[model samples]
Target: MTTRSDPVPRTVPPGMADGSSGGTVPARRRRRQGGERSMVWLYVSTLVLGIGLWWLASALGDNALAPTPMEVVAAFGEGVRDGWLLDHTLASLGRVLVGFVLGVALAILAGFLMGWYRLGRGLLEPWVQFFRTVPPLALIPLVIVFLGIGESAKVFVIFLAAFLSCVIATFQGVRNVDLTYLNAARVLGAKDGTIFLRVVIPASMPYIFVGMRVALGSAWATLVAAELLAAPTGLGRMMQAAQQFLQTDRIVVGILMIGALGFLMDRLLLVAERRLTSWQEVR
Candidate 1:
């Protein structure tokens, strides 16, 4: 048997045919590496410039008020060797951890309820608004009176910071959930709990993450302020002591360490968020 046959040739786009677009993946990856290197160089250059300025000033005026960069670095080394820096660092971070977890847990629970249930919002939002507007420092006197200048006071202040920020975030995240998906879930006869757990919670995670990050910054700042007023030991306590002694090198070292540690903590949160939401589509 014989059959008629027709043949057609198809052409693929030029760059795509070679499994590479205008820029091959390897080339783009190289460009990305170059950019990262440039950024690293820029950061290093700025740090060097700052150190140079400080060094030049110290050499010329023989100033005692401001320590040179090298002096601060040396002080940091000494503090580490003496266990003073490490102990204080751990204490401060521990306070933040306990406080932050308590606050975040409460906020997440309350925020979800408030966002989902109208009655909960009506009941709690007024108080939330009132506290949100008030400065954490202003409440120090009251907190001291109630809880004293102990671990409780420090943790209490940090918890308040984390709570207010997280609640706001949770409320907004719930409100911002896609209405269409919610409706579809409802149409499918999904229970309120199921819809919330499956759809709304997942949808609002990005915003929740954003809020958590902001709250962490607030937690650190608030804890430092609380400790500055009165703490047996911590970074803030050490910093206050340094100020009294006019140990400019130790002060500078403490400040730099705080900033570095805070930076690291934020990066850790970011890593957790990325791992938790690996299945999520980027918005």
Candidate 2:
């Protein structure tokens, strides 16, 4: 009796064995790393270009309305030496932190309730929409009058700004959760609470984070305006005082500081987003 010879096993080439070699996986990783490094260089280049242009314009114009980068740097140093910068920055940071925390907490709670329950939506959505249309800055005068020109007034203005932006974002996020996920959970005999906690919250986190980022920007803008109008001490107040005397360098310093702080806060939130939403594909 003749038996069929066993077929010889096919051999995969090195690197191609797991499909990781043929310049596929490693190439992609290299490309990603290269892209990140390029982005950093681009950021630095743009910043340098911007500063160079500013310096050129200031030198050519020789105007009191604009100051050179060096002048602004000197002004910043002076402020630091006198402790003015530290005091104002700290005060502003404290107000922002307090207002942001309170506003985000309340907004998340309210948004979740409104998104989850039809009755809550019916009761809250119209009011929220109406108030959101009215700019947060418009409420500053009313807040100042009611709360007086104190820290409370400034914090309240920031809180309103953050709350309005965040609540809307979070509400939309919850409403946008995929129906498929909910149905699948129900099919698996999950209760409403379990489905919401396990599926809905995770699904909605991206939206919530987007809201938080927006709220931070709003809070900063509102804080500056509020401080400009009534605060005794803060970055806004510093800038306002500088403007009155045509202290252009100081004004530039304050503006730059505000922008730098806002940028830092946004970066922190982005880190948090990446950590919390690691399950979601980044790109």
Candidate 3:
């Protein structure tokens, strides 16, 4: 009676008792967050390092050919103040958007047909290859003659650049679709149209996006060349004029702006690609 009943021992759950499994999830999350933060710092560091190198080079050279970063910044600000920068940027952006949309749309349609039907591919592949081998810039003279040295000519060149890249990409994507998936869809009693829409498209989207990214770069390059050759107002035109006057700072500004815009667009496409292909594991 005085000793009382022996106290009952407590038993913890397996994972909880060890505190291993229970702590794992939080640890993993922390690691993921740290990785993301490190990536952000890396990007920032890269930009800073590049600019520092550029500045150092300019300072050491002390020449007009290699204008300092501050000089370029001043020129950029001056262009902004003069309203020319905004105008030229808008003009270039408009052409790129229009050309890109038209080219991508047409390429998708053509690519689907060529990929799905043997006869279509036989007939179209030759022409596609021919045009693909021909640089879009090479067609500028012919386009200018036909469409004149106006927006039409410039847009046509950009369109051709985007179209060729996208068509090739879409075609390859379709061809690369897994036969196992297609067979599985057939087993599931999926019709041709349904399989194409659901199975084929989703599976091939990564390739399509790859093509689109390439096309975007091509379009920008073509646009710049077109503008330099004939545009009354655009980044290319601005840079060309600056070159004539030996305004190295302005030339640098234009180069930076073009690079920045292209980089931003590419990033946007990459984000879209990730969202759309979320079901698939990407490296």
Candidate 4:
């Protein structure tokens, strides 16, 4: 038999044998680094441009109605120095956190039941649909009457907002799981519990996360409106108090603070989704 010289060794590059691919690894790393840097710059540029536009708008409008960015910054600093801002921020944040957690937990349970069981869907969906149509803010008066104008009242309104948004999304998510997957698992001799835990839950997780994000937004929106219910200390209360004296800068600070907090929370949720769902396909 003719001895065949090892073709693989000849064809493979010197560095590729060791997985470096003749320095392509470093080049790819550099490109990735460059892309990350570009993203950072793009984000910074957009933020700066927005601030510039806001500054221009303030300069062109009545200062009383539209305070300058500098004025807003000064107000923010003063609030921080007085420590009242921190208190209000914490109070508002606490209510949102509590309401969001409760809403999401109950929503996931109810949604899973409704999506998986015919009787649960028939019994619960009509109520869910009815309440979802009614805005959470509209229920504030009833909530206050029953729960009193206390923390529970505010949290209840926020809970409604979060629950309605989340339950619907989660319900759809669970319902949308591909039947083929279920059949395949069944054919492979997987039991109902195994299929549910291994297939249904993982498949529905994306939808759950999406619902959570929506619920978080709803919770924040409801928080401001909820805090309007005789709250002694909250960003929403602070804004309302400032509005009486036309303190536009303070109002702007509250708006900015809410936006910042919401953005940060959303980003955190996104990071969690990415880490947990790394195996899922993405566009």
Best by lDDT: 4
Give lDDT tens digits, candidate 3, residues 1-283.
Answer: 3775888787765556546566665566578679989988999999999999999898888576878889889999998999999998989899998999899989988888899899989999999999998999988778877998888888888899999999988998899999999999999999999999998899889989999999999988887798965788998898899999999898888888888998899999988998899778543
**Model 1 per-residue lDDT tens digits across residues 1-283:** 9775876676666556657776465566588679979988998999889878878988888666878777888998999999999988899989989998999989988888889999999998899999999988899999999998789989999999999989999999998898999999999999989999999998888888888888888898887798965798888888899999999888888788778888888888888888778667543
Residue 174 lDDT in model 2? 93
Candidate 1: pairs in clash = none
lDDT of each candidate versus the true structure: 0.86, 0.89, 0.88, 0.92
TM-score of each: 0.83, 0.89, 0.88, 0.88
lDDT of 2 by residue, 1-283 (tens): 9886998787776657556767576666688789989988999999999998988888889566777788888999999999999999988888998898899989998899899999999999999999999998888778877998888888888998999989988998899999999999999999999988999999999999999999999889887887965778899999899889999888888889889999999999998998899788654
Rank order (by lDDT, best first) = 4, 2, 3, 1
Off by over 4 Å in 4: 1-37
What local lDDT score does residue 11 receive in model 1, on the 0 to 100 scale?
69
RMSD of 1: 4.6
State the displacement of the C-alpha of residue 216, model 3, in Å, after optimal TM-score superposition.
0.8
| TM-score-better candidate, 2 vs 3 | 2
Per-residue lDDT of 188-263 in model 4, one digit per residue for the tens?
A: 9999899989999899999999999999999999888999999999999999999999998999999999999999
